[model samples]
Each structure stands twice: as structure tokens, then as C-alpha cells.
Target: MGLKSFLSRPLAAYVAHQYQKWALHPEAAQQRVLQELLRLGPATAFGRDHDLAAARTAPDFQQRVPVRDYEALSPYIERIKQGERDVLWPGQPLYLAKTSGTTSGAKYIPITKDSIGNHINGAKDALLHYVHRTGKPQFLDGKLIFLSGSPELEQVAGIHTGRLSGIANHHVPGYLRRNQLPSYQTNVIDDWEQKLDHIVDETLGQPMTLISGIPPWVQMYFDRLTERTGRPVGEVFPQFQLFVYGGVNFEPYRRKLLDSIGRPVDTLELFPASEGFFAFQDEPGNPGLLLLADAGIYYEFIPAERFFEPNPPRLTLAEVELDRNYALVVSSNAGLWGYSVGDTVRFVSLRPHRVLVTGRIKHFLSAFGEHVIGEEVEQTLREALQQFPEAEVVEFTVAPRVSDTATEPSRHEWLVEFARPPHNAAAFAAALDAGLRRRNVYYDDLLRGNILAPLQLTPLPAGAFQRYMKSQGKLGGQNKVPRLSNDRVLADGLLRA
Candidate 1:
């Protein structure tokens, strides 16, 4: 190993060991985080307005501040944009993480000096955990490329504003900078296709050991590399050992991705958002992501079934139970109070606060009172894929198809793009429907009552989803096609494609 690789081993071990101190005692760590947030709360307008200074406990804080989405808190955000000091966080934010997918177009999440570490450190620790556990730090000696957004920032009230990934680019550690690939000029290219071409040209012969990006975009890069070199990605980058990904679940693309590489590589899953970096996979074979308990954020949960209720109980870490779906709510040093991140999670291991991202609170199918979550569909697909080993999924989405005619029964429509189409399509569809029926009782009743017809699968061309995303101008950098929708907007779009 080189100097960097040798030094990284001890540093990685120390970081991982330090992290375990908090992860093992989550309730205590969370209490400390809440205390710190409360200490800083009195300095800001939100803190003063919510009477945060008087609040001594999580319940007191919860009673004073109501859970809200971005739209509900935009008034405070607006003041910050107008150069108001202490409107949200103390003084001014270091950066505003720009993201899309809201009805109000882009959302600008505050990244304060106090809270920026949560985003940056969370990513750093994920790698440290991997090196400490697997004892494989040789990747540190070679190029590590992060396929990300343009690092160029736009001014918003004198604050640097851009995609979270872009903002992160400014903070890449000095040590890793030498190993990072795709020159600044190539990274700043606006067109994703052109950017991919440049990246392929830049790294086609480099010693690339680690690749990180959203799975679909990374898959696109893999496709380009193989096509350009007339070799599998493993042959092209023989030293490549790690695939770090976030934004979306990795399972759906797992088979095709590995097939393209022609070998297995260590994969790490992260749960990151504009709001905060919440969790990352810490163990090699575990699907659960270790929640960052002491990472300058106080977490609260409302049972998924009660998420829409007017006064749902906000349960803290001690109150959360295993295997129950909860809507993740967070209050942070970034000045967000009782902010609903729109995600639903299930605690897989309460001892260390490991969770599985089940779905989004707003992203589900309940058009016919048969609520089908993202986890259910993804899990069902996994089960079905196990039965059909030859099948390979590129991407898929589900939407309800409400019938306009009384004689016709409404049904759920699945649009899937296959890298390798199934030999027996009928059997595959049957496996999916059966798996869903077993997992979701409401869907089972709907099927038995004839209220809904069996789900239909519409196969699309190889790159249909990519084409659709490109048309929407969301082709790259943390954008994901919603897995489930109540309306036919996505379904219709895929069908039209």
C-alpha cells in the first residue's frame, strides 16, 4: 500500500471506533444532540418564536413546535433569502442545498456552519467504516470518482446555492482530492451526456478503484465504458473495489450492474437528502443503514399510519419500536424544527438504531384504499426476481389505473424496463402479484373482492426511463423516478414513451 492507504487504516479504525461509542448508546447520544440544539435555539428567530428556550425535554419541544414540510416553513426560508439574519439558523447559512421534486419547484435547504459537518462527515464515516471493517484501504491509493452535479454555484442573497452534490464538491478532503477524478471542467458540464463522454475519456485508462454515484447514472457510465473499450468494466478498471451509492435503493439495479462489471464489488448504501445526511450502511452484508444519532440532529417519529393526523405523537428514539414504519421528523442545528423529511423508515435493529428506508410518506398508492408502499413493491420485485433468475430489471414504477367505464375494473399498472427480458413474462407477473398480495392485505382484499383487476406490466424500451428523465431535464445528479404514485402521470408518461 502507498502512504495514503497505510495512514488511512489507523484513521479509519479510530473514526469507526469513535462512532460506535454513540451508535451503541443512541438514546444518550440523541439526548445530547437535543440539548445542543436547544442551547442554540434561543439565538434564532424560530427558536424565540417557538419558545424553545423554555423547552427542557423532547415533549416540551414537540408541543411548542409543530411538524412541518418545506412548504409550511417557506415563510421563514423566504426571510433568510432576503438576507435576514437569525431568521432560521444564527446569522447566515453557509450554503443552500438546492433540490427539486416539490410542487413549488426547487427547495433551498439551509446548510449552516454547525450542520454542514453532518453532511460531510456522514459521507466520510461511511468509507471509514468500510475500510475498518473490511481492512481494504488500497482503493485510497487510486482514483475515486464521484459522478455528481455541476460545482458551479448560483448566487442567492449572496449565499452560494447549488445541488447538494455540487456543494459537497467544494468540501472534498485535501487528501482525497488527488485521487478524485473527472476534471473540474468536465464536472461542470451542464449536459449529462456530454459530461459522461468526457468522464469516460478522462478515466478510461486511469487507476479507478472507487466509483460513487446514483445507480442509474453509474449504470450509464458503465455502459459507455464497456461500449468504448469492448470489455467489461472489471477488465477496464481491474482495481475497482467499491461502489458507493445513495438517492435510491440499489437492489433493483444490483443484478444488471454486477453483470456489467462481470464481478462482485463491495457496495455501500447511504440515506442522504438536502435536509441532512441521516444514515449509511455500516456492515458488509446488512441492508440496514446505521442512523447518525449524535450528528447535530434530533430525530422524531410518527407512526406511518398516523402521519397525516392533525396531532400525531412525535416519539423520540427511546419510544420507537422495531419493525414499525414511522415518518422521520428531524430538528437540527440548521434551524429546521420538527421538519418532516418525507421519508418513512423501519427500525431493523433498535440496539444500534439501524433502519431500512421503506418509502416516502407522499409516495405511495392508496387510490383505492389499498396503500402500497415503495418497500412492499421493491421487496415483492426482489422475491419475484429470485424465482426468475434469468430476468434483469433496469427500472420500474407503479401507478394506479382508475377505470373511466363502470364495466371495467381499475388496476395497478407497472412499467418496467428490462435489461434482460424474462423468458416467461406471464409467470413473472404472477409472481409479482402474488408477492404483493401476501405483503399487503388491502391489495389482497381488493383482488379477492374484484374491486381491482390483477396488476398489469407494460414493458418499455431499454432506455425508456432515461429518455423520460432526460426529457424532464432531470437526467442526472440525485434525481430519481418516484417508485409509486397515486396518479397516472408517471405511468402515462412511461406508456407514451
Candidate 2:
């Protein structure tokens, strides 16, 4: 047997055990996880402050610890950074999963050994669970190329910190190290352009079987490979069997992605973040991902409709209803207590719970009180893009234009950089506007009342958004322009580009 296969035996068995437990008694698994977390560091400052030892139930724990974001957790995290032991986790974090997600500026998220192990093991379970269900392992027989972020980490307050993918790349299993493409030197190139070129050069001749990354970055690699080989991606890597993707909604990029790859391949969607790896598409037939309830995270849900409220009632898995959007809050082995991950999702199934990521709680255009969220915008645009089949959306951002004078009324402005602009701009704009109005009652009401002007669309030059991201040093993996924003910072920057 192959070395990877041999090493995978234990993991496969572990996944099997977890799957059985998840299927039969998921709630029991959650209760056990909570107990473990509470018992781990009960004497630490945070633990004692929250009275973790006294908290015997989920409700009691919630009552003890208030929901907080990174800013609120900064004081404890700072202490952890200053070489303090048993601050958040039992000891110092393995590294920090640095990011600039919903809130502005760089965020240094603590990644304990417990948390990083969960990240790696969660991915293993995803692969093993899929193979067990589908009985397909052709992809495993050949090399797997992960087009991800830089692994060359730098020190942050005596702890290593970098992108989550960068940090995880080092921990790749010894058995599969040979099967992974692109040398470590090539993988750590900081410049996106240089890194892209290096990756293409190094991986062009490899016998790739599986390709994994965020959709947009993967699309870039595929496009570049086609350009270099003068052939389709399927031809270039004929053995390619799987495409693993996450980070953003795939609907907008789906058509172009398939078109670039030149054939259908098995696809798995993951809900992985710096904080935790939450879900994965375990079955090809299931449209939503099976929530990894047994993973290290203790999940909570806040109704998106009332998410902005100062103290909205939260629900546990037993109380959540299907088809309702909720802001995800997680208390994890990572030492993040009652932290909102900024993503929103809705349950598609109740038993053996499965969910679909709907949108981001902060990514919305509601400057004029017409609360238009990322989910609504993405859905509307996906339907609208049907009218322009030949055109493909590359990148897009939306901003609210709050006018102070009556002569210049308020409206939402859309800045789109398309691989192929539509034949008719006016029709595309009209279709997009009509779709939004049809989907959102608040938007329709504003249009009817003339409180907001019809949305405007500006077709940016081909590389405008790319250039902007490059300027900000966030061009590649997991770094993306917020699709909808309440402010004009991103919109103005795109215009300047």
C-alpha cells in the first residue's frame, strides 16, 4: 500500500468513529466538547473570570461569558502574546492566523496547538469521509497541488504568525509530502505575481490529480496554465479528479471556473476560517455542507434579522430552525470565547445538521436604511448574470452613496471588473436593479418611494480590482474585496484604480 494510504488508516478510522457518533448522538458530542473546554483552563484569568468551573451547561456558560469580537478579546490576547502561559489556551499558541476580515485593519488571531490540529484534522476527515461515501480514490493515487498562501512566517510578539494556509502548509503529513507540488521556496514568495509565476513554472510538468484553493485564485492558475500550454486545464492535467474550494460564494465564479477547467470535476466546498474549520460538503448529492458539530468548536446562532441588537437572544443547535439565516458565534479549543466569526449561514437540514453559507453580517449596504446584505446581492447578481452568458464577472464591490443635497440623491454604486463586459451596459444595470428590487422588500419600498435612486453600475477596466488588491498587498488567497459595504472607502479606491 502507498505510504499516504497507510498513514490515513488511523485517520479514516477516527473519522468513521466521529461520523457514527455525529450521526447517532450529535448533541452528546457537543456537551462533551463544552465540558472539555470548560475543564481545560478553569483557573486561568478568563476561565476564573467566566466562572468556567461552576458552568455546568451550555446556557450557564453563555450566561457567564459575554459574546465578544477580537477587539474585546485583545487584552487577554495581548497577555498571551507577552509570553504568558495558560492565558487563553493551556500555553502559548502555535501561531497566529493573521487576517483583515469584516472589521478594518490587520487582526492577529491566536492559533493554539489545539486549534491548528483541528484545522488539519478537519481537512483529513473531509477527504476520508468523501472517499468512504463515494468510493472514489483516484485523486489520492496521484499528486495533489495546493495553491495557497505563503508559509514563510514572521515573528509576532515571540510567536509565529502568517496566513492560515501558510501556517498549515508546514504541517503537511510526511507520507503526502512527496505528492504535494511546488517547492517550499517557491510557495513562500510574497509577491503574488512572482508567486503565481513561480508556482506555474514549478507545477507545469507535474502529474496533478487534485487541485485545491479558493475559486478565484484557482481560476487564475487554471487560466495561466491554459495560456502557457495552449490547451485546456483538463488536457494539461488529464488525471485531475477533484477541486476543493472555500472562502467565498462559488455561484458567481462557477460558470467561468468550469469553462476554464474544460470539464466537470468533483467539487467540495469547505467552511474553514482562521478561527475554525466548521463544515464541509461530505456528499456530492447534498447541496449543503454537513456541519462538523463534533469538531472542537462549540457553535451558537444569532438570528441575522436581529443581529445588530445589543443583546439579541441566541440559539443552540437544538433550537435553530431550517431556512433561517444566523450569525455564527463560536467558542473553540482555540481560546476564542463566544466570538462571532462574521459569517452567516442557514440550515438546509435539521438532523445530522447541514448548512449553506449565506453571507457576511458586516458586508451589507444599508446606509439609507435599506439593509441590502451580501446574500441578497450575490443571489440577485447571479440571476442577473444569466442575461449575459458570454460575460463573466471577475470582481465586484458595492458602496452606498449617501448624498447630502436633494439634487444628488442617495443610491448604491456597483463597481464591477469583468473578464468580459456585457454587450449592453444599460440592460445589465437594469437587470441587476430589477433583480435586487424583486428580492428585497426594503429596496423595492425605497424605489417606489424614490428615497433612493436606481443603482449605478460602472464597468471597471479588466485588471482594476486586481491592481487595487495588489496595491494593498492582498491580491491572492483568502483576501477579497468586500462585495457590499456601508461606506465608500473600497468603492472610491476602485474608482481611483
Candidate 3:
């Protein structure tokens, strides 16, 4: 669609107005949102007839309808799997985004036209806000390289089959869509070695102004680029301006990528999922992520402690407190009602509704019942790295595995990769152990009682993480290396020497 057509809709104006109102007077915004929810037939419309009816008749509508997770939507997914179109929505879905599930193998997430529009608008809002903040929209007007998944549509009967990234790419404004690269679409399930070769050849001499993708994939591309050209990526892609990434944490890989590029390029973090586009890094140099509150989706934040609770308090965006971590729950126009996206975040402030992503509620190490998250582990590692400037941890994963001694039960083990041989491996391990202990009291206690073993450093050969990515069929495009493993299965198999 034309830029004017895309921007001139009443929904766009309404979203802008609501955003302003919510930013300024949050209390009034809450009441207005409640009214809007009621007016929209919260339970009746959008395939939520049962929920709407129950909410309307219940004494406390909000309290009665508890928050739900993807598992809770299994029945709906089963219906779709059984070739039922109207199970999720009142009509046939336009597309289904296929994503890897932690346990369910592959999940086909439904998306309606309105939901597609919502995602597009949310992305547009992020771009507009970034332009307003940096006054450099033209910086992004150059060739934008999106490191994405395969664009091929899987042929599945009675199921929407296209990749979500490909669908969104096709639907962007024509003007802003001109300077884009060809996506990786040869084989959806090929090994990373062949894919990496193809991606490197395609991007070598291109005037790439922006690089966007998962950190691990981006690093792989740069590594291959450096090897082929015998120079760092900065010398190769001089026009590169921004590096946008998401789907996983960026902190661990940030230093390496920046060093490889040989300069401080603009980096943008986006919190998007197969379900819908959730949030994006709006302003440069700001740690807080802005929420797309008006993207035709309502947000709910359940306290981190309530993640596994039978019933958790669902706090609306207005009721959510600042500076506290919360598990994100979303109800989008895509027919997902009060669905938990399995992500945890904390609000940095409320005036503009800025937030910081804490971690995934499930991706944590709780062997000693400390509930250590990915962020905590990264932070501790960063602190340790700071003290030993020469030390470089190329790849690492933390897991709670059974201890060697039966009586000890379980302990947190860190599989670490280094650039070179450390002067003192034992000392380095001690430092890391101390860092973790100091960061969290539970780890400290575990260490004293020998519940958690000393930090183990596995001196992987150079290019190990790269090799691991290559083995996983994820060397190129938007795949990220798994950061945390709850058990030794992946760690042993993937990181085996």
C-alpha cells in the first residue's frame, strides 16, 4: 500500500490519540481502556463468545478470566490442526506463523488480517518514534538487510503456511520497502554451512546500511565476511549504520559484534514473536523499550512470582507499577486472549511507558531454588570479564545438572569457551564462582555448602560457537544460539569436544 494510504487510516489516528492520552493521564487511560474493552464486546466478539458472556454475567469480569499460556491454547491449535478454520476466529485466518516450540515441536500460530495490520502499525509507530527521537529517518533510508528465516511457504493442507517475517516484509509500505535484500529461502531445513556460504556471497559487496537479525547469526555472517575479505566487517561494509536484533539476549554478543564492526553502530532491540509484534527500542541510547499500546492489542503483566501460580493478578498497562519485573501477557486482535508470551520485563518509567526486558520466565536455573535468570547470569559474566580484560568468553551456557557425587544431588555447571589459554584457569573459575555468589545469595549459599560446584571452564577450540551454529543448521540469517539449557542434553550434544 501507498505510504499515504497506510498512514491516513482512522485506526492510525485513533492509535496516536490513545497513545498520547495513555502517556499523559494513565488513570483516565485505564478507565477509557476498560470502557473500550466492554464496548468491543470483550467476550462476545473475536471468537471469545464464551469468555465475553461469562465476563458480562460475572460479578468481577477481570478476576474471573485468569491469564492463559500457549499450552492453554492447545485445544484451539488442535482444531486448526484438524482443519477447522473457525476455531480460533470467527472466520478463516489469513496466515499462520510457524515457530519452534519448547516441547510441542512446531507450533502454527494463527494471525488474522486485523492482527497483521496491528503488527504493521506497531512497526510503523516504532519507526516514526525513532525518526522523531534521532531526527535521522534518512539514516535508515539506505539499503536495509534483514537477516531473517527462510521465506518459503510450507505446503500444509488446511493450515496457513507462510513465514511471518516474509508476510510482514511483503506488506510494508512500498516507499520504505524499496531497499531490501533477498531473504534466505533456498531450503527451509538445510545445514548452516551451505546457508552461510550463500548469505556471505550475497552480502559481500552490497551497500548494506542496516543489519537486522539474531546476534548469533549476525556474528556468524561477520566472521565469514572477515575470513573471505581478510578484513573486519567495518572495512567491508562502510555504509553500515544500524544493527537491529531480537528473539534472544544481545548483551553477551554485543562486545564481540561491536569490535568486529570496529565502530559503535546504532543498535535496536525488538521484542517480537510469532503471536504478534510486542515492543521495540524506540530511542537510541535509552535502555527502556516502548510498548505499542495502541496496536489493537491489550497488555497484561503478571508478577514474576505468579508465573506458575494457579491464579495470578493480571495488571493492565495502567495498573502496572514502575521498576518492577513482570511476566508479559498479551490479548491481541489475533484471537489470543490474555495469553502469556513467556517473556519477563520491567518498566523503567511510566510517563512514556518505557520497559527493560528482564528474561524469559521459564529460561532460568533454579537448582538451588534461587530462580537465576539469563540476565543475571550475563550480568555476572560481564562483571567477571570486566576484571579480567584479557579474558574473552566466546560462548557459554548454564545448566543445573546432577552432580558427580550422588549425595550432592544437583549443581549449576557453566560450560565456557575462551579465546586463548587463561593464565590461571582455577583462578578464573573462582572469580566466576565468586561473581555469581555475590550477585545472588542463593548461589553463595550453594557454593559454601558445596550444593553448587565450582565454575567449570571448558577451553573450546577457536570458532567453536561458530562450529556449533553450523552444526545446528543455523549459521546464517536469524537463528540464535541457545543461551540457557535447563539440562545437560543440549550442552553435552551441542558443545561436545
* lDDT agreement of model 2 with the native: 0.79
Query: Which ranges of candidate 2 are over 4 A from the true structure?
Result: 1-14, 102-104, 364-497
Write down the TM-score of every candidate: 0.76, 0.74, 0.68
lDDT of 2 at 116: 82
Give lDDT tens digits, candidate 3, residues 189-304.
24455666777777778877778776656776787788899898888989787788776666656777888889777777887777888778877898787776656566778899
What local lDDT score does residue 373 receive in model 1, on the 0 to 100 scale? 72
Full-model lDDT, candidate 1: 0.87
Candidate 1: worst-modelled 10 consecutive residues by lDDT: 98-107
Query: Taking the tens digit of each residue's C-alpha lDDT, what string does model 2 give over 194-258?
Result: 77788889778777888888765676677678878898898898888888888766765688788
| CA RMSD of each candidate after superposition | 14.0, 13.8, 14.2
Which prediction has more favorable lDDT, 1 or 3?
1
Instruction: Give the worst 10-residue stretch by lDDT in candidate 2.
Output: 98-107
Scored by CA lDDT, what does every candidate get?
Answer: 0.87, 0.79, 0.66
- The C-alpha stretches of model 3 lying farther than 4 A from their native spots are 1-22, 25-51, 54-60, 155-157, 183-191, 364-497
Give per-candidate clash totals: 0, 0, 1
RMSD of 3: 14.2
